[model samples]
Target: MRAAVVTVGDELLSGDTVDTNASWLCNRLDERGVSVERITTVPDRIADIARVINEYRAEYDAVLVTGGVGPTHDDMTMDGVATAFGREVVHSEAAEEWLVEHTDYAAADLTEGTTHLPAGARMLPNPEGVAPGAALDRVYVLPGVPGEMKAMFEEVAEEFEGDHTHVEVVRTAEPESALIDRIETVREEFDVTVGSYPGDDVRLKLTAGDPETAAAAAAWLRERVDPA
Candidate 1:
């Protein structure tokens, strides 16, 4: 399956917070055989969040949203998600109960905003934090905090399964100039992708729909180039 990831937080846009959530989600999604087609970071604004969600949901099988899911004012992801589907933002008593039961917070400590969600959205329980994840149709809303996001995603990871892509890596001391012809030959001979990265040691990555294809492509290149 193909998916898109939208990370919401003004702090991410301002460079105050690094967007590790998107990378982590991408990796996790890939491991589950879901190819992430896009990664977008939006400020904590309802309009921007809704726009990206609306655009991405139409194109990908699923849209995974993270961040801006707290009780605070900047936490506008829920509202944005609601707006994207033209759904009403309703108070979820079930979510409130889940929050109360799962967390140390009392009902008195919570606000209507804390438990509010898009109407018909399914709650994804959070074992690590207060704000629970929500799933409405193809959109899955998750918390921005790394731990909370990871925990919440694990609960829904199975929904995104597809054919897995296998990767093979080759670390070589040969420069790009030395490997260009062989790389091109491998690309033409195999149904795989080859990426060359220049570093202290050149890194060659071969990826394909199956392990055998990737291994064959890597072997083709390794026959001509010396491994580091």
Candidate 2:
């Protein structure tokens, strides 16, 4: 399955907050055998959020939107999604119940704006926070906070599951440039992705559908790298 991740926050765009959500979500999605084609960091603007979500949902099997779902004024992820799909943002009973039962907040604390979800969206409970994750068709809306987002995503991980991929990393002391040709050759020969990283030790990553194919590709590239 192919997916796209959209992170929405003015802080992320201003460099005030690090966008660890995209990387974390990407890794988790990969573990479920879902390939992420794009990782977009967008502002909290409703129009932009809706536009990206609309485009990505049309292109990928699933679209994960992180950030902008909180009590703050800029928390507009839910609204953006509702507008994008031309659905009304309605009160989420599941969200309200989860919040009131677990949190110290009272009924008055749970306003429509804070607990609203896209009409007909499947609610994904937030184990760690008040703003629950929601699924509107192929679009998944998650919280901006790292802890809450991770907890919420775990609840819906199965939705994105697919055939697992086999991956291997071949480490060497040789320079990155030295391994590019061999990496490309092995990639073409085995139909796997070969990644070259420059560092104290160059790293080659091989990924394919099965273990045997990935291992064979790793071995092919490893044979050419100089030993540390």
Candidate 3:
């Protein structure tokens, strides 16, 4: 399965907050055999959010959206989502009950800001915070907070499973330049994807859909290079 990530926040674009959510979600999706093909960062604007979601949802198997869904004014993700699918924003009774049962907030104090969601969206209960996430039309909206995002994602993690990839890593003392020819040879010879990173020690990573193919490629490269 393929997925796209949309991280919404002005803070991310301003570099005030690192977009750890995108990377974290990508890694988790990778482990679940879901390849994340695109990642986008947009300001907390409903139009921008709606545009990307509309585009990505059409192209990928899933679109994972993070951030800007809280009770704050800048939290416009839910509104953007409703606009994307032409759904009306309505109060989610399940979300309100969750707050009353799981949090200290009383029903009388709860406002539409806290309980409203896109009509027909499935509520993904938050295990760590007040605002619950939502799932609608293959668009999974998650919290911007890392802990809450991670916890909420786990609740629906199984839905993203696909063909798993096996990876093998090899470290070499040789420079990347010295290994270029060998890297090309192995890449051409095996059905594996190779990545070479140059650092104190050159690191070669091989990934393939089959475990034996990945292992064989790694072993073949190991025989030709000096191990670090």
Candidate 4:
């Protein structure tokens, strides 16, 4: 499955916070063989969040949104998602019950805004925090806090099917320039994507539809590129 990530927060855009959620989600998705097509960071604007959700929802199989699920005024991801899908925001009964049972917050203490969600959306349980995550029409709304996000994601991780195939090789003595042409040729030949990075020496990464294809491309590149 192909997925896109949307990280929402003024803090992220302002560089006050690093978007570790995107990288972590991508890695987990990759481990399950899912391909992450793109990741976007946006400020805590409702309209902008809706616009991005509408755009990515059409292009990717799924869109995972992190951030803005808090009780604070800037947290508008749930409402934005509802608006994007032309749905109404309502208190989720299941989510409300879950909160009452699992959290320290009483029903009166939970803000009405906190319980509001897109109509017909399923609540993704959050073990780490009081605010629950939500899923609607292939879009997932998650907490911005790293710990809460990770816990909520684990609850719904099984819902996604990833099909990514990757192979990485470290070439200690290889000159990057020497392997450029051959790498490009192999990429075209296998109809796969290849990436080269200079580290202590050189590292080549090949990604394809399946393990066989990735292994074949890696082998071909290894033969043509002189390993140092």
Candidate 5:
């Protein structure tokens, strides 16, 4: 499946908070065989969030949005999603119940500050935090907290399972520039995506959707590269 990941927060944009959510989600999506088409980090503005979500939901098979659904004033993910879908933000009774049952919140006076979600949105339980995530249409609104986002996503990770990917890696003492031509040649000869990087050791990586293709490409590249 092809997907887009949206991370929402002013902190993320300003570098006050590192966007671990996007990378973490991308890695998890890759492991599940889903190709992430794009990763966006938007300020906590409702307009930006709404715009990105609307665009991505149409272009991708699935959209995973994380961040901004907190108790604070800047948290605007739920509102943005509701605006994108032309839906009204209503108090989520189910969400209140989950929080009241699992958290220290009071049932008699359950406030709907951050608990207000798009009407008819499916509440995905958050065993890690107060506000639960929501699934409106093909978009998922998850929390910004890394631990919480992780917990919420694991609950529905199966939905993203896709084509099995295969990877092969080899390193050499030679620099990346020395291998550029051969890497390009290998890519032209194979169905895999070849990548080269210069580090302590120059690293060559081959990735393909099919295992046999990846293995063959790796073997071909291996024969060309001088051993470290």
Candidate 6:
């Protein structure tokens, strides 16, 4: 399946916080044979979050969102997701029970916003933190904190399944200018994407339909361009 990632945080946009969630989620999805189509970082604004979620949900098979699940004022991801899906936000009893049983804090410690989830959404357990995540349709709303996001993702990893192709990189002495025509030819011949990066050295990346296709492309590239 192809997935889109949304990282919601003003800190991420301002460079105050690194977007580790996107990278980690992408890697995890890749291991499960899922492709990440796009990743976006946005502020805590509800309208922007809802717009992006709606747009990507219509385009991709799945959309994974991170951030804005905390108790603080800026935590608006859950509400935004509910708005995007045209659903109301409600407190999840299962999530409340999980928090009461697992965490050191009492139920009263959880802010009203922390327990609210999109209506009909499934709760994804977050052992690393108190706030639980929600899954509605193809959208998975996760906690912004790296620790909680990783834990929640691991708990629900088995629920997702998809197909993915492998990519192999080929570096050669030939400049990208010399290999542009050949790269285009290979792309047209095979069901794959060929990307060329030129800098101090030239690097060609072949993303093929499968492992065998990647091998064949690598061989073809090697035959045409000598490696440095």
Instruction: Kindly give the number of clashing pairs for every candidate.
Output: 0, 1, 0, 6, 0, 0
Q: Kindly list the per-residue Cα lDDT of model 4 for residues 1-228, writing each as its tens digit.
A: 899999999999889888899999999998888889999998899899999999999999999999999667898898789889999988888888999899888899898678878899998888998888899989999999999999899888899886656665636467677777787798788957877888667888787777788787778777876676
Displacement of residue 87 (Cα, Å) in model 6 is 2.6
The reply for model 2, stretches above 4 Å from the true place, is none
For 1-228, candidate 3 gives per-residue lDDT tens digits of 999999999999999999999999999999999989999999999999999999999999999999997788899999999999999888899999888999888998875587888999999999988788999989999999999999999999999988899999999999888998999999999999999998899999999989999999999999999999
Clashes of 2: 1
Candidate 6, which segments miss by more than 4 Å at Cα? 188-191
Q: Which stretches of candidate 1 lie above 4 Å from their native place? A: none
What tens digits encode model 6's per-residue C-alpha lDDT throughout 107-194? Answer: 8887777777899999888888888899999999999989989988898898777886788888888877888788987787677788
Highest TM-score among the candidates is held by which one?
3
**Residue 15 in model 4: shift from native, Å?**
0.6
Indicate the worst ten consecutive residues by lDDT in candidate 5: 107-116
Q: Candidate 2 clashing pairs?
A: 67-144
Q: How would the candidate models be sorted by lDDT, starting from the highest?
A: 3, 1, 5, 6, 2, 4
Q: Which ten residues in a row have the lowest lDDT in candidate 2?
A: 107-116
> lDDT score, residue 168, model 1?
95
lDDT by residue (tens digit), candidate 5, 1-228: 899999998888789988889999999999999999899999999999999999999899999999998667888999899999999888888888888888887866654475778899999989887878999878998998899999999999988878878999977788887887888888899998977777788888899978899999989987888777
Candidates in descending TM-score order: 3, 1, 5, 2, 4, 6
Residue-by-residue lDDT tens digits, candidate 1, 1-228: 999999999899899999999999999888988889899999889999999999998999999999999778889999999999999888888888997887888988886588888999998888888888899999999999999999998888888897888999988998877888888888899998888899998999898998899998888777878879
* Candidate 4 regions with alpha-carbon error over 4 angstroms: 164-166, 188-192, 209-213, 216-220, 223-228
Candidate 6: C-alpha RMSD after superposition? 2.1
Clashing pairs in 6: none
Q: Comparing 2 and 4 by TM-score, which wins?
A: 2
By TM-score, is 1 or 4 better?
A: 1
Minimal lDDT window, size 10, model 3:
108-117
Per lDDT, the best of the predicted structures is 3
Candidate models: Cα lDDT each = 0.90, 0.87, 0.94, 0.86, 0.88, 0.87
